[model samples]
Each structure stands twice: as C-alpha cells, then as structure tokens.
Target: MTALHSSAVTDGDGDGDGDDNGRRRELRVATLVAACCLALVAVAFVPAPVGAGDNIASFWFNPEDTEAAAGDTLELELVASTHGDLVGDGVDELAATLEYNSEIFTVTAIEHERMLADGDSAVEIHEHEEIDEDSGAVTIEQEREPSGDGARTTGPMATVTFEVASDAPSGNETIEITDAEAILISDYPQGTFDRDAHVQIDGSAAAGASDADGVPGFTGIAALGVLAALALAAVVKRRD
Candidate 1:
C-alpha cells in the first residue's frame, strides 16, 4: 500500500489540543492551494491583445519614400498607430538619430506637429541637433506634454525637412533613422518596430544630363562632339 500524506489523519499527542493545531495547519495549506488554482484559471481566460505577449504599440513614417530635385526641399512625417488593443500608456517623448547621403541632401530643419500637443497642459520641449562632424546625420529629441489630464498616444508626431544638395547627382539614396525610442507618459518604453525612408534624386545636373536630348542628354552630346571632330579631320586629310 502507498503511504498517505493527505491531511485526513495524523498522530498527535493523543490530546484534542494537538489535533486541533494539526487540523488548522492542514486547512491553511488547502486554502492557499485553492486560491492559487483560481488565480491561474482567471488569467487563462483573458482575451485577445491582453494576451501577455501581444500588448504593444508601434511608430513609423508615412510615404516612406520621397522624390525631389536638387535644391528642392521635402518633408517626412512620423506617426504612431497602435496595433494590438489600441491600448498604450500614451506617448510622452521621442528621440532618434536620422542619417542621409551628405552628397545628396542636407538636413534643413524639423518641427513637432501640434497634433501631439492638443490637450497637454504641460509645456512641450522640442530640440534637434545637426551632427556637423557628420554632415549626413541629425539627432532629434522631443518631450511631449506630460501624461495625466490629456496625453496623446497616436497621430502625427513630427516633420523632418531635407534639402537636396545643389550638386546632388541622380539616383536613389537612403534616409536612415537609428536608436529611435518612444517613451510613454507612464514611463514605459515601446520596444519593437521599424522605420525607414528613401530619397530619389532628380533634376538640377541630373536633369541637364537626361531631359535635354531624345537620347540620354549628356552622353549624346559627348558622342556628337567626337563624331564631328572626326568628320572635320577626314575633310582635312582628303585635301592633303
């Protein structure tokens, strides 16, 4: 027969006092075990998004790519569209580093959208730095209105402007943003997402090189010059 450890019976001092104490200990243990089981059952019934792993929000840009000519300026906007339950601690701050092809564009300026400040009673701080040592990169940081009494968790956050280099050549270049972090007013940090941007260079010298001729502009002109010089040389040779 297997030994029984159940609280059904126990050897006490053969006195009622010892029996009562042993019974009390067994009752407490049973209560604790029952309470743990109930708690676990409650958690198991929780619904979508609230499911432990799916609770999260994200931040990204709209119109991830842009087309502009040399000397032209363009804007990129950032937005937050929560994916799961649309539940979040509400965003309070954002800090990021943006980079681009220095030879193709220059960081002109940036500003926070008013949408991020609609009901915030606290003052918002907006700051940005152009990394002069690295002409192709800029660092931006913004502290939105504080959480309580009206904080925003979504919508346009900011606009970054880039001026195409006056001498930029044709083709595509990447506008990279890194170390991006969005902090909620509740002090929680959003940890998962991706953001990207690309610039398509056109016009200016690139235009002078493509739109001028039925053929590729610059190459056609160079080819014509060479053929003309050859024809001239042939005429001179025949006369000799």
Candidate 2:
C-alpha cells in the first residue's frame, strides 16, 4: 500500500510539470506572434524618405493628352506645383523651351500666368516670350521683379495656344518641354520636372474634304459601309 501511494504521487507531480511546460511554450509562441505583428504594423506606418515620394515640387502639362481635328485650336497650360513643401517654396523665375512638330502644329500665342505674383500685391513680374515656327519651338522666361520677393503657391506658369495645321495628317503627336530651368525666391535652382503633351488628330475630315467636295467627313470604313448599303438596296429592288 505504501509503495502504490508513493508511485501515484510521483506520477501526479510529473503530469503537473508536463502541463506547466506545455502552457509556457504556448505563451511564448503567442508573445512572439504578437510582437511580430506589432513590428509589421510599425513598419507599414513609417513615412518614406524625401525625394522618394510625390511630395517633391515639379512641373507638368495640364491636359496631358487631347484630341482635335485639323484647323482646330487647342490650349495647354504649363503647370507648376510646389506640393506645399520643399524644393518649391514657390518659384520666382521660370525658363523653358517648348518643342513640337512644326508640320503638325503652329504656336498662335503664349500667355503667362500670375504664379510669381501669388497674391502679393507688392511684387511686379517681368515676362518674355518667343516663338520660332521654323524651329518648332517656343521659349518663355518670367521673373518676379525685386527678385526673391516670395510667392509661396502653385499655379500655371504659362498657357500656350496652338493651331493644328489645316493639313495635318491623322495620328498622335507630342509637345515637349526642354532646356528647362526653375528658380526659387531664395536663388535656389529646382531640378524636379515633368513634361510632354500628347495631341491626337482626326484627319478623316481633311481627307473627306479632299476626296469629295461638299460631302460630310467620313472615314474609309464608313464610306465602304455606305457603298455596301447602297449595293444591297439596289439588289433588293432588282429582286422585287
């Protein structure tokens, strides 16, 4: 009887120790999983370093793409955005050359936007614009007078009006910004930039005018369909 009692106590103690070890292992695994999850969440919420994100200031074209017919007039704005942060505490001066296909487009005029003024009534702006159709280029240079007078904002740097050539062929063309330079009020040069405006032309109207006088503009496929419709009507009439 004594031996059985001792064996029973020993077995109970062993079972209790095994249960305690199992519980400890489970708790350790749960804690590790919770810590891993927290680390992942913290990493996800961290912000990206500067110059690696969209927070940087830049320039681009408004209406990045457009469609028009031959002889149509289109306007494109040179857009500048400071993104409310560094690299563009607002630009005090801008200079860029716009390049296009002279055979497809002609520059009609250029108008500067009051980006430099930025609602500061004390600042005056001096602007210069030039267009060379033969070279298919337009140049714009604008600066705030009494240089470095700040205008911390974003807006159009300029608006360019273009006339599609009367005989421009159908397809897509592009206008690009080049030799670009931007200056901040602090005399700091800006290097961030974006460019290019795509223009899609519908030359079917021009083709129809040349193919048939006083006829409505029609694509080749449309003209063929009409011819097929006429032939079907004639065949039905003959059959009747």
Q: Report the Cα lDDT for candidate 1.
A: 0.66
- What would you estimate as the lDDT of candidate 2? 0.78
Top candidate (lDDT): 2
Cα error, candidate 1, residue 119 (Å): 4.1
Candidates' TM-scores? Answer: 0.57, 0.60
Once fitted onto the true fold, the runs of candidate 2 whose alpha carbons sit more than 4 angstroms away are: 1-56, 83-89, 204-240
Worst 10 residues of 1 by lDDT: 48-57
Which lDDT tens digits does candidate 2 get at residues 1-240?
455444233335566676667778999999999999999999999975544222445677889999989889999999876543254455677788899999988999898888777758577889999889899999999888766545666789899999988887688999998877667666666666777899899875766556566445556778899999999999999999
Candidate 1: C-alpha RMSD to true structure equals 13.8
Candidate 1's displacement at residue 132, Å, is 3.9
Residue 78 error, candidate 2, Å: 1.2
